[model samples]
Target: MLTRDEVFAVLQTVPDPEVPVISVVELGVVRDVDITPDGVTVTMTPTYSGCPAMREMEADVKAALLARGVRNVTVRMTLSPAWTTDWIGEEAREKLRRYGIAPPGRADQGGFVTLTRARPAVACPFCGSTDTVLQSEFGSTACKAIHSCRACGSPFDEFKAL
Candidate 1:
């Protein structure tokens, strides 16, 4: 009979192996959490089709729950609607910023950008500059892109538009 908040709290500790700053919940990988009479079922979607970290993330979640004395944890992967950055919470975005990665855009921003739309403006994390350019559509991982800040001459990874 655990509350949703309690479940989220336990899940907060399950970090993405690639991005330590954001948890699976923050990355919007987890779509649903259901506590059944037998166990807990966590339904998740991969950020991308070929996400390599998804396996590790799933394991982390189950292990975390087991550690918390909750056995029979089940991690279910779903892909019908796909995972999106819009699902990320505000607090998680702040954590990403603090971790040096540019947070995803909000409403009226690139958070919902499709391929046909123009790219969104990315501010520099080092000097708060808007004159940034995309170094590569793909960054160290499939979920992010490399960006360079013109104002401060600093390069950083920006969470790619979902």
Candidate 2:
């Protein structure tokens, strides 16, 4: 039987289907891991409700553990407390920038209240410029917003802070 840490190590190898550059661990979706006599149990919080990639992620998690010789894995999806961009690590932020996607800005004390008004300027991932414009409220993903950098004349996706 594998330990919780060992199972986590295996899970860290499972990458997100939409963002192949980062793993589910780096994405901050894996909430808890438990190793018991029956098998391993993984608790996950989706980035958002009705996220299309969630089922694929569940399968990937199961496949990853099974490939390591641990069978009977259970993946539980939790919604309480919700998921916020604040959960993303610093390393993951830099990786997102390098991958041509602007990471989410810091969440304010009032949470998403700012979203009701004008959105804060999103820095360009290509040129690191704050002079960017929102091209569309929707991006490739529902969780992201599309923006164009005036300085670099490049279009990029900003991971909306939630």
Candidate 3:
């Protein structure tokens, strides 16, 4: 019985386990939300197949929906194609930067391809400098790990590889 806007309002609060600043929508994880007569069925795609945070993310989504008085919730995981940071909208990108994790940077292509977080030139989210490198492939959480910005001489956790 809930409207799509109502659903998205609730979902906005469901933060990404790895990147707190960005919600599942910003990360392009929660692909669809269905308000059916039977119940609510949420379709989602993981950033990657091997993403360890998948279970937690699904649980969080269900819990969040339920908290909004939605019943018969179903969180379905799908990997039809894949996830890309480009799906993360500009507003979400700003939030990511403010969260202190660098946003997507230079790639081999002329930005024609999806913005790739993997092996990207992530600038220092804090200093806004491009001199940054991956400190660790894994981060504090199962979904993200350590990174160091050479320009600002600070270390940060980038979104973990999906």
Candidate 4:
């Protein structure tokens, strides 16, 4: 049987389906890696409650571990603590910026009380400009918001700080 660290190393090979630039480990979704006598169990939290990529991510995790010669892999989805952009690591944030998607701002500022106040300004990933406008709350994915960079005149997605 593979050790927990060994399983995690293999899991690092699995990339997020939506953002192919970073692995799930970088995305901070793989919460826990448990090794058992039978096999391995991966605990994950979805970016959002109804995120479409969660299913694909789970399958990818399974495939990645199995491809690395580990058998009987299992992925468990948990929402007790919920997912937050704060969980995203620094490396993943840089990757998102390089990919033209604005990395999320402080999660503490953006919460379920959006209607109570204005959303925080999202900086442009390409030009590093704070002058940006919200094009739409919904981007290519529910977890992202569409924003246009005023300085660069470019359209980009802002991963919501949830």
In the order shown, the candidates' Cα RMSDs to the true structure are 2.6, 1.3, 4.0, 1.6
Off by over 4 Å in 2: 113-115
lDDT of 1 by residue, 17-75 (tens): 99888888887888889997777889999988789998999999999888887768999
Q: Pairs clashing in candidate 4?
A: none
The 10 consecutive residues of candidate 3 with the worst lDDT sum are 106-115
Q: Estimate TM-scores for all models.
A: 0.88, 0.95, 0.79, 0.93
Model 2 TM: 0.95
Per-residue alpha-carbon lDDT of candidate 3 for residues 61-160, written as tens digits (9 for 90 to 100): 8899888888789998889856765577778878877878655542234333333444656667799776877776656765455778888788986653
| Candidate 4: tens digits of C-alpha lDDT, residues 1-162 | 887788878888899999899899988899998887888899999887888999999999998888887778889999968888888888889999999999888677434736345787888999989899998988898778899988889999988887
Total backbone collisions for each predicted model: 0, 0, 6, 0
Candidate 3 achieves a global lDDT of 0.75
Q: For candidate 2, which ten residues in a row score worst on lDDT?
A: 107-116
On lDDT, the candidate that comes out on top is 2
Worst 10 residues of 4 by lDDT: 108-117
| lDDT of candidate 2 over 44-120, digit per residue (tens) | 99998899999999999999999999879999999976888888899999999999999998766555534457677
Q: Model 4: what TM-score?
A: 0.93
lDDT of each: 0.82, 0.89, 0.75, 0.87
lDDT, model 1, position 77 = 92
